[model samples]
Target: MLEIITNNRKKATLKYVRAFLFFSLILLILFMLFITGVVIYAKSKGAPPLAVPQSTLIYASDDSLIGETHYGEKRYWVPLDEISPAVVEATLSIEDRGFYSHHGFDYKRIVGAILADIKARAKVQGASTITQQYARNLFLTHDKTWHRKITEALYTVRLELNYTKEEILEGYLNTIYYGHGAYGIEAAANYYFGKHAKDLTISEAALLAGIPKGPTHYSPKVNEDGAKNRQQLILSAMVENDYLTKPELETISSQELNYTFGSTKERPVIAPYFQDEVKRLLASKLKLDQETINTSGLRVFTTLDPELQSIAEEQITQTIAKDSEIQVGFIAMDQHTGQVKAMVGGRDYTESPFNRVTQAERQPGSTFKPFLYYAALEKGFTPSTLMRSEVTAFTFDDGRERYVPHNFNNYYANDKITLAQAIALSDNVYAVKTHIFLGQDVLVNTAKKLGITSQLASVPSLALGTSTVKVQDMATAYSTIANGGVKQEPLLIEKVLNHKGEVIYESTPVKKQVLKPEEAFVTTHLLTGIFDEKLNNYTRVTGRTVMDQLTRHYAGKTGTTRTDSWMIGYSPQLVSAVWTGYDRDKTIDLTAEKTYAKEIWASFMEKAHEDLPVLPFRAPEGVVAVQVDPDSGLLATKKCSEKARLTYYVKGTEPTESCIGKAEITNEEAPKEADEEEKKGWFKRIWDWF
Candidate 1:
């Protein structure tokens, strides 16, 4: 019996030991799994967030950042070293008092919070240390679940093991959302104080730090009163933790903050549509993916001049207001470099974003006359070439019917006019006659060579701007003339650099010789006469009187197409184009004024060139100036009326002989005053009086 009892005791002891070993193995496996999860979760965190790209915020040469066109969100990541130390202290004192002493997870605080929750029969508070909160923000969502809590703790431990304390703290401060479309301290500083995080005051820093606790609930945007209350609570916490003395806390709390609750106003709208164009071009031509172009944190240096952009904006706005029906678009470029210096896509970006300067395709109207004359010039037709400006019709086979173009006045003169005279007066009959002389195909070819990329027809009416083209393209075409016949493609962004300051793309202007130097010179000379002599004779207007105050010498053209208005021209220094029409092709109310384009052009040119030196068109090296009859397009004689004709000369290409009696040098004299008085009867006199 004694031996049997001893055997039973030994068997029981063995069984207990076996049970202990199995339980120990299970615990060991669970710990290993937990550690593995922590490692994996830490590696799965999203990247440290960045601010909107610099390209979206274009800056002028003077370092003034232009129009803001940001998407996604505005966040400026700042390192802990860059933040004010007071902000860090204030945040820790309020959000996590034991941040410095605790590890990633604080066991004592967790136990206390749990006990409090049990007593209240509900969860009352959180025990997230600063590092734990940052870990959650970086890796986890705002989920109230045991699994998420466990994951948060694991991520916190992993972060503590891998990163320094300062790095974690910086990550926390920068990754926290502050409501109001702001996602970080830097963004909060900009939104609330209109300044950088580094430049924030102690009060401002404390206020921002108070927000991440409950951004929307305590947001300055939503609950200004709650935000102030939370700010005071932070101040109290700071005092208790010795971050701020009681007296200092009292002083700060009592002071009025005067904070503005919105985005920063430091950046202004210099060029709205231009910036849009830059972004599109960068994404398309450079083959940069959207993420890299918009979020890779690049700095795009553009060719916009804030001064010039401002001038263009002011001109369009003022002109549109004066004539409410006219909505204007303009582009001004440097003739030498093809750099688009200034542009106004519309009167106001917010009012309309059509961006006529780059997108809208309106009829060129008479502004296209230059290209027609250019075609004639290339076909052995000098400015002196004569055409019969009489009414004529042409029939073409377009599967429908023939089209006959007409002059604006709907009347035709059967008399012969020089090519220069035809262009100056903008006579449609003369232009169509010339187009017929040089077949439509040849004219289209010449226009294409002059930088017109718009599709053209083989029909005669195409010479009248039937081919659609953008204002930018038209500006490019005029630039060729201003550049002495070399077409330089317009460029906005000069270069783009990546986040690491490596250049991703650079613009090298493409120069295509479009016209001979002589052809361009002759074009310029003839267009100048339009504004100076013949148009003046017809309306007693002259270039000197149109913008008589301008000290700089320039040549330009004004055009209007029923509902559309345009003014495209060039000086030796700059080439510019301006258009005005309604958003939905509404008719512009020009009243009775004939020179609708001329008004805006004169105002803009005056203001634009106010600070620029008065510079004249630089004649080429071999060019020479000689007096010629602008009316008859020949060498001037004394019989040519000084009022009826003027002089412009091209280098190495002057008239060989004087035009003694080339053609009528003056307008057909109107009926004599005595004859009109005699012809008027009693009824006519009564109608005149009435």
Candidate 2:
């Protein structure tokens, strides 16, 4: 029994030893697995993260044409592929030598950096590897703290697991801010080089690469010596990393830095007046918000000809003159295409915010007479139709007042002036008489069809520009006549392209037939004669004195409203409308020997006509120019001094009879009869009898 019990004890001891060994191996394996899992999880969490839809940078075409933008700051981001290899290598060497090899944190480098810091006992230590720094810049704020560092480490691990190395570097390069309001490598390159990131030079690359450490402290523009020293450090790293040979480094170190920084924000300063119009048109057409319209970085291709724009600016500046306090607005367009080539809203863009060209409504004065005359022409009144340019009156139903029409000189010759002669002289009485004969409704309708959308009073005085209209609308009106009766709404932006190079909007020319080509041509011919005619047989009139020295014959009309002066003229190549007035409409001191209105017009025309070929107005298919008596507006005889006239070419359109034979008062008899009648009036007889 004793021997069997001893055998059982021995067996039990052997089994106990075997169980202890197996349990020991199991615990050791579990311990290794836990450490491995922790390391893998930490590294997975360390990867640098990225947010969607990064803020993009926008640029203007040149330094001279910029639209106002309200961005956080202008930044032009360059893609990773476009950046120079040297730029990337140099930045990596200076910032993080172990960037490629490290998962997110480089413990070896961090320890060495800390040791070096302890030895130096100075706060100039940066142990952050390129990957770690990228992680910090991307996910963490700039405030330094142990707690933040711990969080940065966790994020670094996340970044390595989530994103690729190349992506982290890209985000690092793009997201980091360099001082001087720049936020990316691309912006820094442009900010310094006045060129795109793809256009950066080697020296420029190094200069920017050195900015991330201390953007403000070592900015090349602010501290050249500090930048140079920082740059030398980076160059040494590049040499050590085999990015550059020693010889290349030596050569680069000796070269002078020819960096230009303020050149960075080069944006085009385009026509502000046209830009404003574009915004308005886009708002109405595209139904866009102001924020989107202003900052879309949209590539707008306009119909503006650069040459014409320069000419227009020069013309306006010359016309308004540096000394004049008057503001002037002008716009010129192609008669056929309706392309607005040149426009100026005010004398100086910087001085004024008021856009007078498309705004400000003032009575267009005698310039309004053309619409009434055109109505009469369409109503079977030939250019030679007889009209009385004598003092005229009308009694209104309100019993308020009767407006007697008088010429600009406050004198009226009671002669039977032909329709053409009356228009040429811009006689108010003749315009009123013709307007009444045709009816005021006819004139208003004709004017509206000719692109005059301004409100018109339902009275005969409407013929005298009693209705106020803007310069742009007036330009549209005249352009219709110049365009041979097709009304085209003026356009500014031709197309808009988005950041990804997608076209968003393009303009299609919108045209509407507003008048018969024949009517339009007849009006053009009559207005042309007003400029071409020599004052003969009509009373020695005081209106615009005809200057015969001009070699070219073009159609134009001048106007003087209560306080505004205007000139709307057209040649074969361009149509120009000009307005000059004070902001608050004060009657311009016409006492000045030469009123500013005419001088402004003359100056603008002289400059505008310089490059434009002297092309004559093309009369439409059925129109013809013929010579007639300026006084009688009839077929000329040998006795007529002003025998030159332009008559319509249509068959049956010519005046068959001479006004010399038909008129009740010849030029000589009318003035005498008017004086005799005036002598018999109550006030006149009292003065004469006394």
Residue range 1-690, candidate 2, lDDT tens digits? 999999999899988888888887888888889657756877654533354223322222222334545365554435678777878888888888888887877788778878888899975567787667766776778788999988787777677777778878877776677778676687677677776666766666777899888888889888989998988999889999988899999898887866667563554455777767767777888887776665554556677666666766765665455776778778878777788877778877788857888877888887787788777877877777766666768655475867777787675657677666676677888887777768779988988887777888868788888888888888888888877889898867677666434788888998998877777777776666545536444444222453432445467777776687777777766677878888887777644412455555555555667766787666667665566666666776545534555466444777665535333458888898788977686975532221
Q: Compared with the true structure, what per-residue lDDT tens digits does model 1 show for residues 1-690? A: 999999998999989888888888888898899778766766676333323242234556566667443465665556677788878887888878877777677788899999999999998977889888887777778888999988777777777767777877887877788887776687788788887788877677788888888887987778888988988888888889888899998899887786777645654566878887888888888887776666555667889988888877776666555646566778989988899988778776888877888888887777777887776666666666656666667666653665667765565556666666666667777777667667778877877777777787767777677666788988888888888889888888888766445777888888888777766777786777556555332222224336564556677766667777667777777788877676676766555333545666777777777777777666665455665665455676776646345444444445676764535433433345557777899976642321
Ten-residue segment with the worst summed lDDT in candidate 2? 52-61
Compute the lDDT of residue 662 as modeled in candidate 2: 31
Clashes of 1: 2
Give all TM-scores, in the order shown.
Answer: 0.76, 0.76
lDDT of each: 0.72, 0.71
Instruction: Please list the residue runs of candidate 2 whose C-alpha ends up more than 4 Å from where it truly belongs after superposition.
Output: 1-68, 77-176, 185-187, 237-243, 263-270, 282-284, 294-296, 305-307, 319-324, 396-401, 535-553, 591-594, 637-642, 649-651, 657-690
lDDT at 187, model 1: 73
Best by lDDT: 1
